[model samples]
Target: MPSAPTPALPQTTCKSLDDWNEPTHARRIYGNTWYVGTCGISVVLIATPQGHVLIDSAPEKASVAVRQNILSLGVRLVDIKTILLTHEHHDHMGGLASMQEATGAKVLSRANVVDVLKSGKNDRRDPQFNELAGFDPIVNVHAFEDSSAIKIGSTQIQHIPMSGHAPGGSGWTWQECEKGVCKNLVFADSLGSISDDSYRYSAPDSLANALRESSQRVAKTACDILITGHGTASDLLARLDGAKPLLEPQACVNYAQAGALRLEDRLKKEAVK
Candidate 1:
């Protein structure tokens, strides 16, 4: 007898691209940390009495809404004295030129990323450079070494280099306090092995080794709350809805492990090809 016919899988429809830039009301993530980016991207504001530190600026098109989000939080854009980045992708740093021009905030990131930021050009080292566009140039960018501490008022942000997603990709760790208790907040870089059709994880120039080491470091890092470059990756919305605990001690480890598995799978497919 013939085998049973295979059942068709459910078809998935692409979500509306407009939803990516739609203005979502800003909300406090925890303590002084607030979410101010779009529904698709992750931008965080860490408020300090002296000033404020913003992480990532979304794309240029959505920057105005991001600024509005900040204003809605009762924090002046001028009060943003420091701007840190998770990576130098156009989607992440596209608005740096506008935001920095408006606030004159000191931009900080890994040295290589700073170069890319200043040039407003895609870094050749990036695996997807040919498929990506450059953003507005940001002048006088400063470099921060891995594990360096950046202090703004009472808040301290530690930079951790995780260079696999992007050559200068990095993550941030900080402590937010409320009611005499503090929680460690981690903003991890994009960890998925995403690329255009022509790109391969098995390419000689791929930063697979660096990415593996970075994933290991992230797995070992202590985290109470985890935030990622994209909201969906870390379930930022579900957590905000009170359905999930604010403090997830093992979140980073899980994130790293998942990323590692993705890398392994990509390499396996490449080997077969």
Candidate 2:
């Protein structure tokens, strides 16, 4: 399918480096998949006839902006039934509590992620825990193992555990159809090996191994379209604007390779320092 035309959205930010929480117009990814997030973060809404399932709820400061953005796409606030989480960081899921209340949707994530959100703090197990931020306590959160999945109507949304960058980190994957054509879609979380000062990626229990394994898993998943936590990670905005191919068979592999390469370089630099 050809990509859709993107409206001219203003170039706005939160006045902080790497934080673009300002609201932007929503656009369709494939058939039922919609991108209703801010300029910096990416939030996916899989709308089904029965209800909807949102991938991530941007940062907390943009809570209302995200809600309005979803509403702009003609989605009823109450119709959002389930919210699938990706990473447990404040930048990624800080607004989950408000989103859960706004839509009255149940939150689902990896078994270990449930604890971090409940405490409204960063996970100590994360490499960047020292620099991470906290958010409002998320309620009605439940745990799902690798074998389990949540659904929206007939769609089966599975949670893929990608817990290297952030402990208990995970991504959401499912299929969406348009004109009797189905495409595999994945809301992949951040896979870069980012950390605070004094943290090493070359330790005995270093997360580098997990990051590499997760890359392999995502590469094998074979998604038609891949969405990352940050729009620039996959050039999502460009893809949506028809600047790039909306469907790329090698996109997942390329994404996985890029993430793995980043980790490889980070480890190499850490060793020399």
The candidate scoring highest on TM-score is 2
What would the TM-score be for candidate 1 when compared with the true structure? 0.90
- Runs in model 2 with CA error above 4 Å? 1-19
**In model 1, what lDDT does residue 121 have?**
88
lDDT of 2 by residue, 109-169 (tens): 7887687878898766789988987899989988877636776668888777787888777
Each model's lDDT comes to 0.82, 0.82
RMSD of 1: 10.7
Worst 10 residues of 2 by lDDT: 1-10
lDDT tens string, model 1, 122-217? 766787877888888898688877779998766789888899888889999999877999888999997878776777778888889888988988
Per-model TM-score, in order, reads 0.90, 0.91
Model 2: number of backbone collisions = 0
After superposing candidate 1 on the true structure, give the runs of residues whose Cα lies further than 4 Å from its correct spot.
1-19
